[model samples]
Target: MAGRRTERIDEWRERVDELCYDGERVEHRLDLECATVVVTTQRVLAFVPTTAGPAFRHVDRPNVGTVTLETSQRLAVLCAGIIAAFAGVATLEMATSITVSSAVPSVDLEGIAPLPGSNLLVGFVETVLAAIETGLLLLQWSVLLAGVAALVAAIGLITYYIRSRTRLLVVRVSGDDDLVVPVSGVDLEDELVVDLEAAIRPAPESTPALEAEDGRRTSSRNWTEIDHEESG
Candidate 1:
């Protein structure tokens, strides 16, 4: 029989371990690029890994006060601005430097020197290459500009994908400071939010004798919700 390999716990996991109590265990975890949001049996943990060490914060499940969202489009706007400037400069320079050339020189024989036994003079112009036509030059720059536009569009898409996704969750506790955790991807975000709500908000206790149509709403775990709350 082959033995199973155990998962290694690094420094970051150690930090996560220290955030929990002796009996508290992690229930749901959403791992992001630099941060992780964990829903534990008794708490919610926000862990950020850095060069020096792991920075971690947590709040008791019942003490959670407000959960807000912070969204930003600054990076996307900055990228668009910088690339627009670059494209303007590049197009202007090309327009100024790409003028039509009409200095083509043609060679004409003044006098003929005869060969040894023949009255014919064999002429060979060393450099007789014709310059590119004006229309063709313009067309070339047009193609180059198209290529540049394609490149800029590609960069814009890439920046939108990477730098523009700065959505985060700001969890505020009753007396503690807010814990900020970066979130990405729809699956992770949905699952984490669901687990967090389940952990904090209690489910109604029901027996077989209680019918749903005849029961009134219980207020055991009732909490007020502040919608559309923005955080920085």
Candidate 2:
């Protein structure tokens, strides 16, 4: 598992490397289950690749603001949705089954001649229930497939939660969405966080260099005055 994680990080680092402009160097990167946050000298970039193509969001280092750990309900909400979907699928299947099974007659209708017409009625009811069950089964098929997908998503998110070391970093930026990176397995406590906070922090004011030559100017007016006094 650790080896696979390394490979994944390497792949993202390559991708982040490709997107970097000439002379821009990657300093720190936080790899998440669904996205990657990369900090460079010039800017901070968040990448989330989709089926369509690669997606990107970034902020210049100057614009990167205060970074704080915000409590996240994203995992909780997703888990709830997955649980609800499974419950719905089970409930639907249960209801359909109950309806289907109840229509069968306990006594044999074929043996009684006086209730010949009654047999047809029972057969009609059974046929209707069967059709309903078929339709419900198709609906359940779709629901079941959706439930499985949710389950997979839940598992992935759970992995992310554990690997993040129970951390949620929210990178506040100016004029852009905050970079909410769900981190993956990496002990970047001293290195990565400092790099990001440095971006957020205002740069220290620089004092002007005193490199210019400082001297009293020998003015043309002073020369003219001296010449006039001499001529006088």
Candidate 3:
């Protein structure tokens, strides 16, 4: 009876080994809780403190990555303010120069004191118009810059959202365990799936025989060879 039980155990071990040797195993699961996103991976479980819940856990698969979101309004307003300030300073400088030049009595208006007053008033009004034009130009530039910044930020946020919530899957043949690798860099999220698939490729036909030969060589190297010819 004991022999039978031993045989059964051996058979069971062999079955498990065979299943692992010829199995397709790929899986991923992801979840979320409040501010923290829980990413779980199959077979590659990480041990955490019991206080955090279960001691063993894995990252979430079949889910997208993480995204940090923020509003660009502050940056936009800052840019608009800077543009407006620069335009204000430039307009003030140009207006001052215009006022000074207007005060220099031109020969055309030298004899007519009242006409000079009218001309001076006209120059003052023109300066105000020029200042207004500067303000308008600054406003237009600010709007354009703000629009471009918002567009860029929106596109970035959208891309982040899509990638974060994307479903990632893995497929493997056998082994009760799966490995989930955190991928980074350009276009690596999708590439991770390909890499996982490649990891399960069957070993070459001669690999096992070669491994056996290597084992023999290693054993031989560990001990001196006994030869009758050397003894003679």
TM-score of each: 0.41, 0.37, 0.29
Clashes of each: 0, 0, 21
In Å, residue 185's CA in model 1 sits off its true spot by 4.2
Candidate 2 residue lDDT tens string, 1-232:
6465556655855677787899998877766565667778788887655313335677898887787665555566556656755665665565455543344344444655467587677787668767877776676566666656665665666666555444556788888677776544453365666666875454555523322212123465678889999999
What is residue 205's positional error in candidate 2, in angstroms? 5.8
Query: All models: lDDT?
Result: 0.59, 0.64, 0.41
Instruction: Flag clash pairs in model 2.
Output: none
**lDDT score for residue 75 of model 1:** 65
Q: Which candidate should be chosen as best, given TM-score against the real structure?
A: 1
Give the Cα-based TM-score of candidate 3 against the true structure: 0.29
The lDDT of model 2 is 0.64
Worst 10 residues of 2 by lDDT: 207-216
When 2 and 3 are scored with lDDT, the better candidate is 2
Q: Name the TM-score of candidate 1.
A: 0.41
Q: After best superposition, candidate 2 residue 193: deviation in angstroms?
A: 3.2
Ranking by lDDT: 2, 1, 3
Q: In model 1, which runs have C-alpha deviations exceeding 4 angstroms?
A: 1-36, 50-54, 66-72, 75-164, 174-176, 184-189, 203-232
To one decimal, what is the Cα RMSD in angstroms of model 2 from the true structure? 12.3
Error of 1 at 116 (Å): 49
